[model samples]
Target: MKLKRDFYLQDCVKVARDLLGKVFVHETKEGIAKGIIVETEAYNGAIDKASHSYKYKRTKRTEIQFGLGGYAYVYFIYGMHFNINIVTGIEGEPQGVLIRGIQPTYGIDLMKERRKTDNLINLTNGPAKLCQAMGITKEQYGMDLCNSNLYIEEGISIEDKDVDITKRINIDYAAEDKDRLWRFSIKDNPFVSIKVKS
Candidate 1:
């Protein structure tokens, strides 16, 4: 079953952790690809220094986050890679959950071809890489995940013992927020972007 809007209308930190073990599906014109979410990072809006919408800054790229939850916040980074985040919280709250990694379960050939790699471990090990392999891009920005082609589905039930909480990656500039331990990933999941202790 597809996750509902209410499923995303909660605290970002909770949503990020809950998203693990769920299925992330992106049905594109090329084909449909599915994967099990294994990693995620949460950014608390308005107050979080790591968030683009910190202080309620509403630029073109960040305005989507200020809307109701259950939307896809796709953004371009490094002028090359596209990263996807799930908008969370109520209107104007602007919280987000970044899907950092997934293990491909369907359309493996399409994912491998998109990534130009035959190594299964390298297919969707990172945020941008998973986006590429799944054919997700800026075009998917602000998509309503509750009803759109891009959405998460109910899959495996994740237990507390199977998850590891850690600090986000490469956001040391967020001051104390860098150590907030907002990142969540399945323990021992080889598809995770980074390995860190809880």
Candidate 2:
């Protein structure tokens, strides 16, 4: 079943952790690409220095983040790759969960072709990589995940023992907020973007 808007209306941290093992599907003109979510990172609005909407700072690029939950907040980074984020929280709240990694389950050839590689791990092991592999782009921004071609679906249940929490990656500029354990991943999942250090 596709997740409803209500599923993303709660705390972003909760939504991030719960997203594990769910199937993220993107239907494009090329084909349908689907994968099991393996990693995610929650960014709380205003309070989270690492968040784009921190301090309630609004900009053209961040407008979608302030919209109602269950919307896509896709953005381009490094002047090339697009990062796909699921908008969470109430309207004007500006919270989001970044989908970091996925294990491809369908359209493997399509994903490999899009990513220009056949190696499974290199296909969708990171946010930008997953976006490319799934054919997601800025055009998808503000697209409602509750009723869209790109949406999450019910998949395998992940137990507590399978979850690993850690600080978000590549946001050192956030200072103290960088240490918060907001990143969640499926423990021992080969598809997870980064291996957690013991």
Candidate 3:
């Protein structure tokens, strides 16, 4: 079943952890592709220094975050790749979960073709890599996952014991927020970009 807005309306940390093992699907004219979410990181935009909308600072790129939850907060990072985040919390309060990794589950041929690689482990193993393999782009920014071509649905249930919580990656400038153990990943998942980082 496709996850409802209620799933995203909860605490971002909880949503990040709960998102493990869910099937994220994107349907396009090219075809439908699916992946099992293996890693995620949560950012509380209100006070979290790591958040783009830190202190609720809204810019052209961050304004979408201030809207209701269950929307895609796709952004271009480092001027090269796109990273997709699932907005969380209420209409006014901005929060989001970054999808760090996914295990390709459908349309393998397409993923391989887009990534220009046949190595299964290399495809959709990182945030930007997954977006490329799944055909997600800046056009998907602010797309509501509740009723859009891109949305997460039910998948294999992941137990708490099977998940590992660790600090987020590549955000050393977030000060104390960088140490927060908000990154959740399915334990021993080969498709995960990185393992638990202590």
Candidate 4:
């Protein structure tokens, strides 16, 4: 079933922790693509130096980040890739969590069509790649995951023992914040770009 608004209304930390076992699904005109959410990174709003919306600074690009919870906050990075994040926390709060990886559960052919390659291992292994496979883009920004075309769903249950936590990768710039250990993922999930010890 599609996850509800309340599912994402909680704080980023709780949302990040609970997201490990959920399934993220994208239904497109081409086909249906799905993945069990195997990894995620949280960015606390304002107070967090790691958050782009830190200090609640609103830009044309970040306006949606300040909207009600359950909205998508997709943005382009490196002038080439799109990173998908779900806006979390209460209204006016800009916290979000990046969905870093997923284990593909459907539409392999469709993923291949979009990616134009045959290497299944390379298909949805990272954030940008997964967004491409699922047809997510800036047009999808601010979409309500609870009722939009793109939404998260309940999937295979994972035991608490099977989930792991660690500091998020690629943000050593956050210094002491780098050690917050806010990243969460399923242990040994094949789609995860990084391996984690449980």
Task: Estimate candidate 1's alpha-carbon lDDT, on a 0 to 1 scale.
Answer: 0.94
- Alpha-carbon runs more than 4 Å astray in model 1: none
> Could you give candidate 1's per-residue lDDT for residues 88-141 as a string of tens digits?
999999899999999999999999999999999999999999999999988999
The lDDT values for all models are: 0.94, 0.93, 0.94, 0.86
Which 10 residues in a row give candidate 3 its minimum summed lDDT?
Answer: 189-198
Per-model clash counts, in order, read 0, 0, 0, 1
**Residue 144 in model 4: shift from native, Å?**
1.1
lDDT of 1 at 180: 93
Residue-wise C-alpha lDDT for candidate 2, range 42-138, written one tens digit per residue: 9987799999999888999999889889999999998999999999989889899999999999999999999999898889999999999999988
The predicted structure with the larger lDDT, 1 or 2, is: 1
Q: For candidate 2, list the clashing residue pairs, or say none.
A: none
What TM-score against the true fold does each predicted structure earn?
A: 0.98, 0.98, 0.98, 0.95
Model 2 error, position 183 (Å):
0.3
TM-score of 2: 0.98
